[model samples]
Target: MGHPTPAAVWIWMFPLLLLESRAGHLGAQETEMLEGQECRPHEQPWPTALFQGVQLVCGDVLIDDNGVPTAVHCKKLKYTVRLGDHSLQNKDGSEQETAVAQSLPHPCYNSSNKDHNRDLMLIPRDRASLGPQVKPIHLADHCPQVGQKGTISSWSCVTSPQENFPDTLNCTEVKIIPQKQSEDAYPGQVTDSMVCANESSGADPCQGDSRGSLVCGGVLQGITSWESDLYGRPERSGIYINICHYLDWTKKTMGSKG
Candidate 1:
């Protein structure tokens, strides 16, 4: 469940809609994961929720004690991270909030209106203490293969796209699609820095799914990259930045930071 359709976005979470209007760096339709199922109370804990003041901004994954990656467009937000958070409406007492120490978006990130090349950013774990409910995932050493199955986790508003957002974590299974196929969907915008995925059953969103992370075979494989609104369309595909492609930069950034 991801990527907000403009026609359907107004009916989703209010805070997300407001955030998109301001930056829209991930694109207008790239906000919320669509048609996702809620996780059990505190079932999965690696995903983190980012916020600007009180507004929900983006969903991120903790890759290490000192690194959590998200979209570069989210840079302007008053950065704060919520760990061990499963519910958005109700506090389950597992939630722990911490201010981000700093962020380093890719220096080569292209900010063109139509192209979102290298749209990844790294934020340190900061002062948040780690525990059972709060842990980091390992980064992918090898690139994800085509047709590989992966799970995407995000703070989605698909089920209750209205005044109230769902109170649990949302995630869905997606398969990595061929680069050529994704190329056809995105045209010249598809680059080596990016990868594509699709929810085979056509159950959920096809693009960027709003900064959601693509985890394959138990490791962080890709980060969602925003794209056109392909919701309800016959061709189903989602764009993601291949995390393995930027392994060097990620390590350097994390190692050089606090």
Candidate 2:
């Protein structure tokens, strides 16, 4: 499955449509072996549901001081973080929900452009506790190499424009695409703060996968941001907000808020 189109396009396509919308480093061979591995229940614990009121539009979880990280575009909601759950429809004892007290999108975030610069936001949770099944993912200390492999997980739609989100969490492997290659595919859209990835076999993050994490070598490298188009085209690569590029800003924001 490939990622779906952006919500902006989905709305025009279907006026009646409802809204919605990683692992460690290893040898090259070892990395290839881990691709597309389905995460066990709460296996990747840091991935929490980012909700806008009642709708799940992105994935988020704790960073520090009860702060959660997600895409800046996701700031448009009265957000909540749902932790420790694999299935959204069926919540077990492990699931915990926390209200967001504050949301701080990056100061340079610009929604009108496709560049996706500083496309990140931090949400402070109210009285949330960290447990075994709910934890924070480490942010990457450096940027990923162009060919490095990474992992992404989400409960978002598997099929584009279809709302076929899985009951359980899903994951896929992706290889980083070089800036030149990404620019060739996206044409003037890939910015320094953005990264691109795609699977040769055609799996991708769609509409519902926004704000999800891109983990590389046990650290978060990116945030699911946007795609080339609204339709799911396997050949088209997906764009992400490069976490490494904004580490200083992230730390400053989180620190200042506290």
Candidate 3:
């Protein structure tokens, strides 16, 4: 697909903003990959599925001290995280499954709001088995500036909702968009706690991609919160929970929780 102009990007994102209620949950069955490429083994180990039985809702993994960081809204449902597995259907021996002993959503998380600021939660596992294929990622010390590039990885759908989720992991590169652009697209909803990124061609996170990791310079910069479109349109950008803005909260939360 051809790249979308900034004006087109904003125009397309506007209507999506109004669908925030249905857009927020970003259901697993309706998610798609939208122009992303398959990820190589071990290229992104920090992203794992937050699932209840066979159903995948979002992506998550160990961030610090066996704590798994994901979108706070996912806390509403119970999940067992599977790490080191690329294919959700077939798992290699490298995969390790663990039950969540407890969850701690950021104290400031407000589900009633649409911006989804502080959209993060930490799930602590009692006996997590870590190895090369399953390890913790470092949280970024600073938020990426506008125009910086990052890679987002997930195992969600590779096409429209009519298709099945990919058996292998998928990844795509995205550039940080200017805050003003995000503000214009999202209006007063955009906040300091959120960051925005897009591809000129409109590649972005879609449904079932929430809580996925956004990595820049080998650091975990953000977590997928929501996107502008449900069908994985190439003209829309995605919003992420800025890890840098929540560094203190993360540290304190992880330290306090068992």
Local distance difference test, each candidate: 0.74, 0.73, 0.76
lDDT of 3 by residue, 1-258 (tens): 999999999999988886875676565424433668789977677777777877777886578546788887776456687788787787778887776668788887877865477878888776557677887889898889988999988765566545456777888898988887877776676788888888765566655368367888988888888865434443357888888998998888777775
TM-score for candidate 3, residues paired by index? 0.80
Q: Which candidate is the best by lDDT?
A: 3
Error of 1 at 230 (Å): 1.8
TM-score of each model, in listed order: 0.79, 0.79, 0.80
Task: Provide C-alpha RMSD values for all models, in order.
Answer: 13.0, 14.3, 13.2
Give the CA lDDT, 0 to 100, for residue 248 in model 2.
92
Best TM-score among the predictions, by candidate number: 3
- By lDDT, is 2 or 3 better? 3
lDDT of 1 by residue, 110-181 (tens): 776656788889988664577878888899999999889988787654521222345567788888888888
- By lDDT, highest first, what's the ranking? 3, 1, 2
Off by over 4 Å in 1: 1-35, 159-165, 205-211
In TM-score terms, candidate 1 sits at 0.79
